[model samples]
Target: MPAKPRILFCHCNYARVVPDEVKSSVLEGLCKSGQAFDAVADLCEMAARRDPALKRLAAGESPVKIAACYPRAVKWLFGGCQAPLNAEHTEVVNMRELNAEDATNTVLNKTLTPNLPADGSVAKVEGEKKI
Candidate 1:
């Protein structure tokens, strides 16, 4: 079996779009589901500062799924980091608009399924059509 993608949940410390209780609920659900993940206070700032943890995450070959705000904002935040994250190998979940249950469901569905495109390309799970 392929390795499971790492799930990263952003608390959006500064913006405060995703509430702390929501984040906690999602994290607890993920843990109970046997999915491994990391909860970060602020992914944008971490990427901006080139934090070592971010570097380590970037260096990994496994795909990554980020649960945060808008997809565009996540992309912009990671843009300045030293290590490059190929767009194909990443996925973003819009936690800003989703409740804790919905966010957890999205993360679990993406990480636990064999949803990658047959062409060996990266795809984003946004709506009905995978991007």
Candidate 2:
């Protein structure tokens, strides 16, 4: 690979729900859209996987760039990355918040924001970090 871009997905709670078919479709669309890398799924999976590669990227790369579908995803990878990565590169797509599901409209609206502590700690509901 020719210097692959470092893509991270922060606080992607819907990872389990994001159907593989949708993922493939989005990736195909992205490939057609432009020259953007097809590392979206990998990045998201890595974040979910809590891979050390994220920290390595922050340590080695300059102008460490990331294109996330969610800003919380950035925050998720931020502390673990071991460097002060820019917040700008992170993008937050309000799927649960903005997409506005009609079925759970009442419940979702009340719980839109990311589940975070006041001290900025990710309230670990699931998944364990691999040592």
Candidate 3:
């Protein structure tokens, strides 16, 4: 059976929305380069759909796992993905803040950082948060 896909988030360090033009350019670059991986500009929005943990949060229920302790800000973006993810394999970069509104002008010659494991395994991205 084909293994489940790993997921990762490339977050901007800055706390702002990356321009739509920048996002499109990045995706185009990835497709042109023949790289493999899913990219989400608004991690929170993506998390809200795919992450079971974040789904629970959306439902207003508290998560039981240690992941319940991470700050909402850190998790608000990634907590929604389904778990059993390869811990050593997954990572989230702070990119929003770095890219900011000027993302179009700022060149990321290297487009779309890898967000998942190559082996197609799912992995957790963050720790728990305490209420």
**What TM-score do all the candidates reach, one by one?**
0.70, 0.41, 0.36
Deviating ranges (above 4 Å) for candidate 1:
110-131
Candidate 3 per-residue lDDT over residues 1-131, each given as its tens digit? 32322322233323345444445554454456553544434445445456454443233221111111122344334333543332333233333443432332222233323233233433454564522
* Candidate 1 root-mean-square deviation in Å: 9.0
Given candidate 2, what's the lDDT at residue 76? 57
Candidate 2 — what's its lDDT?
0.39
Error of 2 at 101 (Å): 15
Candidate 2 residue pairs in clash (backbone atoms < 3 Å):
10-73
Better structure of 2 and 3 per TM-score? 2
Clash number by candidate, in order = 0, 1, 30
By lDDT, rank the candidates, best first: 1, 2, 3
Q: What lDDT would each prediction earn against the true structure? A: 0.68, 0.39, 0.36
Which parts of model 3 have CA positions greater than 4 angstroms off?
1-16, 40-42, 49-76, 80-87, 99-131
Taking all chains together, the TM-score of candidate 1 against the true structure is 0.70
Quote the positional error of residue 91 for candidate 1 in Å.
0.9
RMSD of 3: 11.2
